[model samples]
Target: MHHHDNPPQSVPSSPAYIRATWGGTGSVEEASAAFGFSRAKGYDLVRRGEFPCRVLRIGRSTRVVTASLLRVLDSGEPEYSGTRDAHTAPA
Candidate 1:
C-alpha cells in the first residue's frame, strides 16, 4: 500500500469569510485570496507597484483598505493613478 507523508491542504477561505472576519481591513494575502489571486501574485503586484487598490504598508506588513476595495468592487475601477507616491503608507 502507498503511504502519504502529508495531509491534503485546506482550501483557501472565501471573500465573504475575509470580509466577515477582517471587517474594515485585511492583509494583502487575504484580499488577494478573496479575489481569487494567489499570494505570490498579490505580493508581486505590490512589489511591481501595480496593485489596483489602496495598499498600506506598515513596516513590513501590507494591508488592503476595505473601503477602497469596496469602492473598486462597486465601480469596477481601480483607484491607482500610476503614481508610486499615491501608495505611500500613512505616517
Candidate 2:
C-alpha cells in the first residue's frame, strides 16, 4: 500500500477532459490517476521503462507527455486518429 500527502487527481477518461485539463506535459501522478493507480506504481513503471506512455526526465523532475498519454487512452478506438476509416476498403 502507498500513501501521499495529496492524492492524485482523478481525471476523466474522455479525450476532451484531457485536452482541456492538461497542457503539453503533466505530472506522473496525474497520469497514474488517469489510469486509476497509485503514483508510486507509476514511478516504478517509469523507472523500468514500462509505463503505458512516454515519460521525460529533466534533472530530478519527471513529466509525462500528454499526447502519448492521450494516445494510450485512445487505444480502444476502432481506428487510430488521422488513419483511414476502419470499415472502408483500402485505396
lDDT on C-alpha atoms for all candidate structures? 0.70, 0.73
Candidate 1 residue-wise lDDT, 1-91, digit = tens: 8878887544445444445566767788876776668889988887766666788887888888887776666677876523667655543
The alpha-carbon RMSD values of the candidates against the true structure, listed in the order shown, are: 8.3, 11.3
Best by TM-score: 2
Off by over 4 Å in 1: 1-19, 81-91
Model 2 C-alpha lDDT per residue in residues 13-79, reported as the tens digit of each score: 5567788888998899988888778999988877656678877778999888889888887793321
- The lDDT, on a scale of 0 to 1, for candidate 1 is 0.70
Which parts of model 2 are misplaced by more than 4 Å? 1-14, 76-91
Give residue 1's error in model 2 in angstroms: 43
Error (Å) of candidate 1 at residue 86 is 8.5
